[model samples]
Structure formats: C-alpha cells, structure tokens
Target: MEAFFYIVPSLMIAALLSGVWRLMRRSRRVARAWGGGRTAQARCLRSYTTTSGGGDTMVSTTLHHVYEFTTREGRAVRFEEANGPGTTLEGDLVTVHYAAGHPEEATATAPAPGRLLAESGCLLLFLGVAIAFCVLFMVTAHEMFAETDGLMP
Candidate 1:
C-alpha cells in the first residue's frame, strides 16, 4: 500500500506535466501557423439559462454579450480593456489586437479580469493541493519502508 501511494503520485505528476507540455506546444504551433496578426475584434453571443423545479416552469435566457475576439487560425483568444466592464453586448463593437504577420490572429482589446482571476486561482489551488498530497504520500511511504527494514531498530 505504501509503495502504491508513492508510485501513484509520481505517475500523476508526470502525466500532468506531459499534458501541459503538449498543450503549450500545440498552442505555439497554432499561433505560428496563423501568421500572427494581432489587430482584430469580434463579438460573440452567449445564452444563459435558468431552471425552476416548481410546477412546470423553466426559463432560458438568450442574452447577447460581446465576447473577446478570437482568430480563426490559432487557439482561441480574448482580450479585455482596463476601463469599464470588459465584456460587451451582442451589438457592441470592440477593438482587437492581432499579430502583424497573421492578420487573422487577433484577440479582443481588453482584459477579462473575472475570468482570468477565477481560472488562475483555481489552477493554483488545485496544483498546490495535488503537489502537497503527493509529497505527503512520499514521506509516509519512506517512513514505512524505513520501519519495515529495521533501520531505526
């Protein structure tokens, strides 16, 4: 059981690192293929839904919000500006930045504070907890092995 715990963590970390590496490589490759143009913005529409269990009433909302622009070629990209709410409505026009080389490679011209913060926080928290657990497992396993081997006796 101790050995299993020790090995599982190492395997998990290895898998995670490999997956991240692959994603980064793929993102870079797509960015390069898009000619890297950075000036473009487009509006995206999203629909929100609300559900109620009382009676037979279900409500779905189709609100149009302007999402950050993304290029067709590379990985999706969105941008938000520092001023005002970065998100825009369906009919709202936004400026996008693109790579000059790839005029089609563009993102919205603003920063998405809420999305960025939430995503970053979740990622950090998950990684931190995962690593801590893995380290703890390793330490426990080492102690178990030492005791079983009569090293401390």
Candidate 2:
C-alpha cells in the first residue's frame, strides 16, 4: 500500500513533466520557423468559442479566429491561429508570418516573452507543490507502518 502511494504520485509527476517539455519544444520550433518567414496582411474571416471541461469542473472557453491571406506567389491560404482569439474582427486586417515553403502554417501572433515567462513560472510552482505533497505522504505512510510494526509481537 505504501509503495503504491509513492509510485502513483511519482508517475503523475513524470507524466506532467513530459507534457510540459513537449509543449516547450513545439513552441520553440514554431517561434524559430516564424522568425525568418515573410509577413503579409491577413483578413479575419470569423471567430468561434470552444468550450471544454463542463461536468463538475470549471468550464473553460477559448475563442478561435480564422484568417485568410494571399502569399507573394498569389496563393490564397486560410488557417486558424493557434492561439486564442485577439481583438480582431471580421474583415479586419492583421499581420501574418509564413514560411515560403509552408504558407499554410502561418501565424498571426508570435509568442510574447512575458507570457512565456509567466507560463514557466506557473509550471515550476505547480511542480514544487506536487513534489512536496508526495514527499509528505510518503513520510507519513512510512511512520505509520513503522509504528504498526513496533506494536506487533
């Protein structure tokens, strides 16, 4: 039972760390790709809200914006921005960055340094708290088992 308690939290923390690492890696790749890409004016086509986590948990909503832009080669491409919707409206002109080879993978917004810092800080904070709780639970379980063993025979 004590082993199970320790193993479960350890697994959970490992999984969380893996997910965070993957997200950071993908963000860096996209940022690098956009840095050398060309910029063009894109028009906002529409906006829609996506909702998740409804039952028993706090419902979260994200607004997605679809945009259309024409490349220098006169190719028309439409794609939804990866980030949530901004202050853009229908038919509004926004700046888009796209690589010459992959115009479909365009982005209207670049990752902000401040936002990235905040996200990293939050992840660190959560990791610290989770590790602390796991340690506390393991210590408590060890003490209880020790006391029971001492009482027997």
Candidate 3:
C-alpha cells in the first residue's frame, strides 16, 4: 500500500510537470523570438443580447473580440482560448509571439518560467497541477488509513 501510494503520486506529478514544462518552454521560445511586433491589444467590449419576457433567459449571447497574429509569411494565427468576451478585446494591442517554423503557433507573450510552472491563475497548467495534488493527497490518505485499520474497505 505504501509503495502504491508513492508510485501513484510520483507518476501523477511527473505527468503534470511534463505538461507544464512543455507549455512553458514553447511559450518562452515564442516570446523570445517575437515579443515586440505589430501585435494589437484590444479591450474585450462585450454586449449581451436577449429577448424580453422570454423563458430562455438562461441562454446568453455575446460578441467576442479575438487577436490575430500575422506571421512574416503572411499567415495569420491566434492563441487558444485567448479569445472571446472573457479575454482580451479585439482592438487591444497585446504582446504576442509566434513560431518561426509554424506561423500558426502563436500565443500571448510567454509567461515567466516560474509563473508558468507555479502561478495562481485560470490556466490549464495550473489546473492540472492542482488536480494532481488533490489526487495524490487522497491516495496517500486512503493508503495510510487502510494500513492502520487492516481493512480493504
């Protein structure tokens, strides 16, 4: 049981770390190559439209502003989830970086390595780590409890 606890946490942490590392590295390289350019940072001005006196009030509509990155090859690319009413606006000029090899590979300015790996935000990377920690804690507690009670349940 103890061995299982150690192995499970180690694997979970390894996977999470690998994913976070990859994203951080990719984002960093992009920033280093194209930190300053013709990037536009626009504020996300949103408007909700709905029908009056309608039972479908729960349904909502919004106009999202997206950022477009024009690579040197005349190709346009945008960051993932970096669009919509919740993200930066259309007219806002945001610092962006792109992959020289694949123009389509672009994103908002690369975050600091430390920030990318261990920062508090709504990013998927952070979420992955958080979930991994939760699982690890649960597994460890269960193993400890099972060992003490000598019961499988």
Instruction: Give per-residue CA lDDT, model 2, range 59-147, as digits (tens).
Output: 98888899999999999999986455567788899888877887887888764656765776687677778777877887776787788
Give RMSD (Å) of candidate 3 vs. truth. 8.2
* Per-model CA lDDT versus the true structure: 0.54, 0.76, 0.54
Off by over 4 Å in 2: 100-102, 121-125, 128-153
Candidate 2 versus the native: TM-score?
Answer: 0.67
TM-score comparison, 2 vs 3, better candidate: 2
Q: Go through the candidates in order and give the clash count of each.
A: 19, 0, 11
TM-score of each candidate structure, all chains considered together: 0.43, 0.67, 0.39
- Tell me model 3's lDDT, rounded to 2 decimals: 0.54
Error of 1 at 153 (Å): 16
Best by TM-score: 2
What does candidate 3's lDDT look like per residue over 26-140, in tens digits?
5565554464443433222332333334485565454433456566666656544332334454466666555466445555544454564344333565758676685869676
Whole-model lDDT, model 1: 0.54
Worst 10 residues of 3 by lDDT: 40-49
